[model samples]
Target: MKKVIIVGAVGGGATAASQLRYYDKEMEITVYDRDTTMSYAACGTPYVIGGVIEEESSIIMATPEQFQDKRNIDVLLEHEIIEIRRSQKQVLVRNLATGKEFTDSYDALILSPGGSAIMPEIDGMDGHVFSLRSYADMQAIQSFIAREKPSHCVVSGAGFIGLEMAENLSHLGLEVAIVHKSASILSILDEDLSKILQKELLSHGIDVYTDAVIDKINGNTLHLSNGKKLESDLVIMSIGLKPNTSLAEQAGLSIGVTGGIQTNDFMQTDDPFIYAIGDATENDDFITGDPKRVPLAVPAHRQAFIAARHITGNPIAKKGLLGTSILKVFDLDAAMTGLTETQIKEKGLLAKTVVHIGNSNAGYYPDHSKLTLKVHYNPETRQLLGAQCIGGKGVDKRIDVLATAIYGGLTIDDLQALELCYAPPFSSPKDPVNMIGYKAIE
Candidate 1:
């Protein structure tokens, strides 16, 4: 006879709602989302824009009716929960469709407001700027591309989203330019490996501009802080995202240093009955044990399951995150996990980094590309702190292995002992992961 209320309906919120049904069949659960739609995969958005996904509906995983009939969870799309009253164990929900407000009481509440894309404040950027955060945002980009048929495009930022968008936009035969303020693109990849990635971007006919920032936008032209002018048909801003903690903050919840909701190991906020998950909550970093905001769908979903278990009297501690991520640009793929060398140095910790260059398969194999693997380890402990891999194939596989090692608290030497599969078309006898350990010893 317990009722659970969830805010937001994507990623963590939706996952928790569905899992709660399997855990406690009789638990009353209701989900409210500001977006007038059910849960959809946001990660496939760039592919949606690139025409790789012909239908936007293809990305939508579940509809409200599906959840209602099968899971028995009430889904109220466009019903935004504007306020949370901890004392009353209820939230003020606004029917965005009808402009009516009502209170929904709950025995337990979970907040997963997710993240908002950063929009740069600049002159003359009123309509020319677009960001990909929601399904609507992705649809807007596709519509613009289809209607305008823009020949030249300027992308601001060179992170994962920016790089992926750049590749997708370029694949549509549009001339693409990326303007990043940082010294290198893909900052998560260490400087050395990132340089190689920048080379790949350039080889794909995508112009790369480093040490450049947008001062303002005049029509379709961008005035750069580094004294360069870029004219484009449209602009995409993939700068980054911050935790969407506005609602949680207004509810008198404590915000963490990472600009996310502060929660304990049980994902419980100051109020025990209320929990925070997804990008809106800070994660304990595996390497440093610091509160880190990892706006990733995997960690968000995992946290939601753990939080739901705790609410059902099956409390389990939420472990730290490694910040594992991956992206594909043209024929090349990149994936990384844990801390980077720059991050380690920023924390005043000495990291021993080893870059292993090996083939995805044996050198005699027909389809082979040189895979660049960069691993960061503690100088004294030799524990794996982080890793970055860039190649045409096997990049994702190796990063996941290293990510697991980091999660398992494995050291550089531990990678050498891993019995990875080896074959002509797959991996070399001395796999790059094993080579990483062999190099670290030297």
Candidate 2:
């Protein structure tokens, strides 16, 4: 039986451990995480902070007891893997609680330590600031909020976590403002689309500022580069994240252009016996075939299964990701798949895009909501390259369908002819997807 050792028991590591046990019950599987908790939903941290989720414990997917009792997997909680000695096929493990260190050997190793939130150094940036990357961060912020009763909270970025923090802070009845260093909010979206999102955020009474960066934070005041200062009681930094690759790099694993552990279609790293998955691994883009770091839960879980299958002789290869993602702020929902127009142009690809405004369902439907759909296509062949959507109720569905289309290499003609279910309560005979396709044909 092969001895498998896994590091960092988040979505990727946890799924790999479970799948490994399923593939080979006789294999000795040991999972190690520095956190005291077991497999939990890190993505749900924002909801817990916003008060939408009443209990922090509910976000945890499984406990250490569940892993051992149910899966027969040994989970070492509060144990950290400080070093990986690939030549010896062993790892140096340290017990965070006991301050004791040990070494363990493995036939195969999987790296999935994930990424940490970026906190830029600004004056007065100490315990008063927060970053919602882990469950502990969530707990810490909740405790501080309860104890301090901050009246105004300033969120220092406007990406997914940044905006989510802004919304959740408002839910807690605290005045929130989002300060984005970039010219537009949601830099992931096109500039024009970002304009629309800014309007929506403002409509909800959240202060949205762009091209604005904090110079320093001084006791209840945020000094800005524009020589302006805003008073706030707390600051949540959501700038960005860099892949945690120290363990992999130290072990002589090859890193990619994107700063993530490089892996092939089989999710195998440079060393055949080693594999890396999840937020820590650089993945291939389905459209561009370039390495990109997509740090999301579903991709991490899927990659984990792929890595396990390959190691166990099942060998199910992983296709590239389209980087499909979604976000919700207050009542509005936005989803995107494949490349953005900015990316397309930057790549020097000859492409054009069209944006359409329509309703989620039929116009006559009572609960219908407006939707903005933008699609990128190869101008010469009208091939569907990418799509972005913003709306309520039906945003995820549309983006999901487009994601499939891009994966299948469907062209404009193909999308227009695609069959889809339709009802007044759900969609029109010509769904928004078909409309974009039909427009592309025009």
lDDT of 1: 0.90
List model 2 lDDT by residue over 1-442, tens digit each. 7999999898999999999989888889999999877788887888898888988899899987898998889999899999998889899999999899999999999998999998887898866788888888888999999999999988989999998889888988988888999999988898888887888889888887788899998878899877889889889999898899999998889999999999998788898888899999999988878889899988999999998998899998888888899999887888898888789888998888877799999989899999999998898987778899998779999999989988887886687888888999999999988888788776
Each candidate: RMSD to true structure?
A: 1.1, 1.0
- Least well predicted 10-residue stretch by lDDT in candidate 1: 120-129
- Each prediction's Cα lDDT score? 0.90, 0.89
Model 1: per-residue Cα lDDT at residue 73: 97
List model 1 lDDT by residue over 1-442, tens digit each. 9999999999899999998998999999999999976689999999889878888898898989999999999999999999998899999999998999999999999998999999978888876689888999998898888888899999999998899899989989999999998999988888888888899899989998999988989888889998999999889998989788989889999999889999999899988888999988987988889879888999999999999999888888988898999999888888999898788888988778888888998989898998999988887988888899999999999999999888887889888889999989999888999999887775
Q: For model 2, which pairs clash?
A: none
